[model samples]
Target chain A: MSAVALESVTVHAGGKSIVDGVSLSVQPGEWLSILGPNGAGKTTLLRVLAGTIGFRGEAALRGRRIRRLHRRDVARLVALVPQTPVVPHAMTVAEYVLLGRTPHLSLLAQEGEDDRTIAAAALARLDLEELSGRELGSLSGGELRRAVIARGLAQAAPILLLDEPTAALDIGHQQQVLELVDRLRREEGLTVVAAMHDLTLAAQYGDRIVLVDDGRIVAEGPPAEVLTAERLASLYGAQVRVLFDGTTPVVVPVRT
Target chain B: MTAAREHGLPAVSAPHVGVPWTLVALAVLAGAVLVGLLVGPVPIGIGPIAGSALAHVPFLDAGTQLEAAQEAIVWELRFPRVVLGALVGGMLALSGASYQGVFRNPLADPYLLGVAAGAGFGATLVIAYGPTGVDGFVLPLASFAGGVAAVAAAYLVGRSVGGGRTTATLILAGVTVAAFLTAAQTFVQQQNTESLNEVYTWLLGGLATSGWGDVLTVLPYVAISAAVLLVHRRTLDVLAVGDEEALALGLDVTRVRLLLVGAATLGTAAAVAVSGLIGFVGIVVPHLVRLLVSSSYRVILPLTVVVGAAFLVLADVLARSILSPAELPIGVVTAFVGAPFFALVLRTTRSSA
Candidate 1:
């Protein structure tokens, strides 16, 4: 069975369809990357899979309808790393990471020893153990992103949704974050879906890429097939050169 | 565990940072209750007060060295007043902290969503048109109804204006509803000129007339509200991450918000109905607790309950004793402290941002 499936999913907001009819499926342990320009409904599609927004379409996780599932059940199956998460400034990193355990605990139940151990494991996996006692406000930009990823890891969900996960990171940190996610996906047999803006990184890491524009899929396939120079120029409305580096596609913007 | 340590990851324990804070808060509350019982116009000594309290315990024979009048002052008057102050203070602080969590606004207080105005309008209406010698039930009941109604109206108005999507719209609707209710209350006060003194006294807020009846009347509502707020302390912490993130983390954001708001409103209304319109205890006490303890709502909320209770009982003591005869309004004392602290919070948050 597919890990996540969407049949003609559509989301409307402010009198317009932010995510138009879209249909797709992700296999278990597959890495599916969504690339789009601004306002292309990429993030909205991820939100639909995360079950954080309402959509007018059939969306299912492991054969169960998403809308029919309780929020806690959905959370136990999927975890989302929001692009611009609100970080409570005074919240310590340990406390912030523990929020991921909310789905497992009863409403009034405090975090248990098992939950803390899991959170600590996630923090360690993300190389954030040293920053555990530091407040979120004190972290650098890259550290904050990693902390957010640690939170998602602590959820212990099989399917992960990342929205612009590398937006603010430097090149080294970007590679570190993406490599960490790739390792987790490989080692744990986790399904990975990411909405990314960097085409080169998408080409390098995405096993399959889906290019969207105006809330609809415009192209889909391997990076080499979908990210040609002509297609990138016409779809992105930018002049760019597509280079092949040992079967991997590299996108470089060209001056007008 | 060995593998994790190999990667230099420490096996962190549960972040139980609140044990000491809980003890401190409970100690403060105990001290405040003892002070409330001992210090009064009758000047009862601590030894005698403890002796008087111990004398009432079963299987204990502590000397009851106090006269009947002094005993009555401690038990009949000051005892009920302190208990009422505690209930009102705890409710306001808990509600205030919950409101701040739900709205993610630092300035949010128990009165943010029109409770004060609604209760004021209700009490003013009763005082203006009701019979001169109406029983105590009429006024408090009317005030309760008015407070609940005002919040209901605000909620309805907020929902009508797409408040379901964002808390900003709901807060705006609260401002509008509060303004309208305050105007109506002013009109009633102007019309009933003879009742102005009584209305003024109530508007200023006090626990001066508190008794066993007032204590009993507000106890159940306060208890229910406090229980709900305390249970949702962790949920409030989740809400701090914003609506979309909180929802993604498996919370029913809209439902959680509605339930918490309802709980806070119920407690605030009940407390207001009995204690008049005590201000700042809601804002001041919760913020102080937050400053002193961990910012996590798990810590801030429970600590706020005890600290708020202690703070208000002590403030009420000052209200009644500062002038030594003519009592100052409790609301005035809280505002004096709350307003400056509010400014300090604003400035610090601004600088940090």
Candidate 2:
């Protein structure tokens, strides 16, 4: 069964369509990467799917229309890790992650022992146990990114939406974060939707890639089929060389 | 991995530290209240006053005797003033802390949305033009109405400006409204210089003439507002991240913002109505609690109540006794101490950041 489905979803702002009519679906436990240039409405589409914004057409989660679901119910099914979430300077790493348990809690209920255990386990998975006690202001950029991903993981939602999950990380940390997410997807049957910029990384990790440009999906298929030199040149308006290793394609920009 | 392997899972639980800190705060509040009761222009012995207070408690009796004049001074004058001070202090601090959390701005206070200026303008109007023998409720009623009106205007302006999405715009709206109201108040004061002293006294804030009726007037509003804010302590924590994240986490961000702003403003208006415009208790107490205790609102909100009560009672003590006989405005005393402490907080936070 499809975990998420959007049909003719449209978002307009300031007399311009931020997310033009777009239709897509993701099956349970599948990893879908949305690749696009800057200002391509990738974030807006993610927001639409997360039910954080208003849209014109149908958006559904787990076969139910997103608008019909309670905000808390939608939150329980989907989690979005934003591109650059604001971190409270004085908040501790553990405290920030524990906020993921909010959907499961009643209006006046406190975070119980079970919630703490889940958060602690997420911290351990992210190798953030050491920094759990540290204030957010003290974390490095990579550590902060890991903490944010850990928070998403702690939400325990079936579907995860990550926007530029590895934007600020070094190569080693990037691999670790993506690998951790991929492992979780496999082990827990978790469906993942990521809005990513790196073509190589998205091609490697994404089971399928959707290329969005100007608020519309231009191409959608296997990474090898969609990430061609012609498509790359037109989409990015830059000269690029596509290198093929076995069945995998690696994009390399051709310097003039 | 090395750090984790060495220490096992680092303690992810919120430190079980709130209880001890709360108990210490309660003790400090008790000591401050005792000092507030005993030290005044008309000296009263601690033993007899303590005994008299205990005697009044249901099912408790303490054998002590006091002169009639001393008893009247303690019961009729000092006790109500201290209680009123505590109530106003707790309301302002709690409202301030909640405002900061909701806006996710450390600079937010109870009056950030123009409650003080509104209340000042309202009081000035009453002093300048009201009948000579107005009833006790008239001034407080006008002040409360003015405060609520100001915040309402600010909220409307903020919503109109940025659809209420940005805290910066809301604060800007508040500053604009505050400036307008202050100018109006100054104009009124100039027109009625005969009532200027009364206007100035109310603007500066004091609890010199508090009675049980004054305490009773604000009690219900303060109680209800405080309860509502306390229940949303966790919600405030969610809001600290930002609106989009909070909404994504299943919180009704707009509803929470409206409820918090409404409750905080209502309580603050009631407080300012009774006690005039007591400054810094709202801004200083919550930050102090955050610095010393916990940053979580669950801890910060409850602690702000006790610590604010204690701090204000102590400040009021200094206000009345500083020069002896001639009392200083409570606002002056709070600013004197709060400015330096705020500076220290800024320096420390900056260096650490």
TM-score of each: 0.95, 0.94
TM-score of chain B of 2: 0.89
**Deviating ranges (above 4 Å) for candidate 2:** B1-10, B14-17, B58-61, B126-141, B155-172, B192-195, B346-353
Interface RMSD of each: 2.5, 4.0
| Chain B TM-score by candidate, in order shown | 0.90, 0.89
Report every candidate's CA lDDT.
0.87, 0.86
Clashes of 1: 0
Residue range with the least summed lDDT across 10 consecutive positions in model 1 chain B:
B9-18
Candidate 1 displacement at residue A39 in angstroms: 0.5
Runs of candidate 1 exceeding 4 Å displacement:
B1-17, B130-141, B152-173, B351-353
Clashing pairs in 1: none
Across B1-353, the per-residue lDDT of candidate 1 in tens digits comes to 44445656666554444567778889999999988998777788998888899999988977798899888898889999999999899899999999888888776675667877898898889899999776366776687778778888877998899845566677788788989999999999999999999898888888975449889888888999899999998999999998888888899988998889888887887888778898878888877877877777888788888888998999998888898798999998888888898888878766433
